[model samples]
Target: MSLPLISRAPGSGRRTRRLPLGALFASPYALFLLVVFAVPLGYTVWMSFHRFYFTAPGAEVDAPWVGLSNYRDVFTDPVVQRSFFNIAVFLVINVPLTVLLSLVLASALNSKLPLRSFFRAAYYLPYITASVALVAVWSYLFGTDGLVNHALGGLAPDPSWLVNSSLAMPVVAVFVTWKNLGFFVMLYLAALQSVPGELYESAAVDGAGRVRTFLTVTVPGVRPATTLVTVYAIITGSNLFSEPYLLTGGGGPDHASASPVLVLYQKGIEQAHPDFAAALGVVLVLFVVALSLVARRFTEKKEG
Candidate 1:
């Protein structure tokens, strides 16, 4: 008295499918992304299009609506324009310095040297160090009466390194490149390690000198790392804030070193104009995206 093969259990005509284990595991992160990133990004974009403001009496809830005016003001504002220019200058100075110096350091570290481990640790120390702490040290060193000025031996007659309008951006660029160098070096080191020794051997067999081998083999082999480093440099350089904020107190002398993020903070937090800040943020996002695309275009290897 066994059931036939076509027999079915009661209420078993339809069955629901279970989610894949991988999706189940990933749902938490997906939810977190939705709550933390997606929501905020959407709100910022929405706020950018309105004349949103806090109520006067209670400073609660938003006020009237205006379209595109905030964006218009951001574009026309001289201070915002200057901030963008300052960031451009920083990128031009910082990106190449970061890439070249990190590559050189990685190449040197890749070779046998005394105290190589110690040097590696020492170089990477700045990157893991807190920006506030690093800025504090830099501030002490770059002050008018600081070690740098003292070391100059009256050559520049008590130069103001961090406070000078012309020099502030460059000084920030130098510190930023120094702070970020170790990370990039580590990246290049890892990339260099993956490059086979056979390639170098082949190059040497072809009568290539060390420099020529590096130029032909090493550089070409690490093109992916170069592209990564370029994108990182652009993003970090554009969003720069911590060093300038700590070293020069938000904006450098006459806003010479103010970045978009710094200006956004001033508008949103200090001035209580979140709408304008949102517009500034959107503009900054666009700027970074455009720059990243341009960088990728140049860095990506072209196929013949």
Candidate 2:
């Protein structure tokens, strides 16, 4: 009689494993990112170490490797230095303004207020509007003969909002804050909803006033959202390009309103210094990353 056939686990002897359905479904997005982001990022890093220049199709050019010379040049460049400073100022104003206003507006909207839906839509309208259109309206409003100047009359600065070197970046910062406020408000709104109603009841039970309750309950409750908003504001503020580009006319008035990205465009695309621009882009990325980390740390720090 033959020995009893031994039953084994399914696929126990197989040399290969079947791909997970989740991975299979994710492959398209993975491939897309590899092609679009990874490849280009790799090429940029490679170019940053060389003296790269554009050449016509089928043309060969000597791209000498320069190690960190590109980086050194980027640091020494005055335009880049000024751009960094400008971005710092922008962040200083934009980050706090955005966070505070968004949180306050969200709190008000979250309360029993009249026309709540209409106000939410009204606030969000600017965020969804085309930047080009917004810039045009802003230009008109802040121009030498614009409504803002018209309203200010004799109180307006001598050089107007967009032209003054000291005011240009600040104006850009404010404009960005106003434009993106609704999105951050939405984030806070979601965070606020997630907060336990019990906390509010307890706070009220303790005789906490509105402001006290908000500080004790609402603010701490949305810590995660605050961190998110802070980091996002920093990143977006650092990469500011279009607002300054269109609003300040390509970072005019001695490049006072210029951002690192705007400078990168000027160097990389406009000036045809792709290698140098690549280096600048790399540095900007590092800077933004550093700033984001610092912001996250500050926001997420435990109260001692």
Q: Model 2, range 1-304, lDDT digits (tens) per residue? A: 0101222237654676576986889999999999998898888899999999988999999999999999999999999999878867887898789889999999888888879889999999999999899999999999999999889989989899999999999999999889989888887887788789999899889999999998989889887776666677667766888898999999978999988899999989999999999998887777777866665554444221
Best by lDDT: 2
Give the candidate number with the greatest TM-score: 2
lDDT of 2: 0.84
The TM-score of candidate 1 is: 0.83
Return the number of clashes found in candidate 1. Answer: 0
After superposition, which runs of candidate 2 have C-alpha atoms over 4 Å from their true positions?
1-28, 112-114, 289-304
The CA lDDT of each predicted structure is 0.81, 0.84
Clashes found in each candidate (C-alpha, N, C closer than 3 A): 0, 0
The per-residue C-alpha lDDT of model 2 at residue 269 equals 93
lDDT per residue, candidate 1, 1-304, as tens digits? 1111123336653574565986888999999999998898898889999888766785666555788989998999888899879877887888788878888999999988999999999999999999999999999998988888888866743348888888888889899889989988887887788788999999989999988998999898777677666677667766887877889877878889888888898888789988999999888788777866665554433211
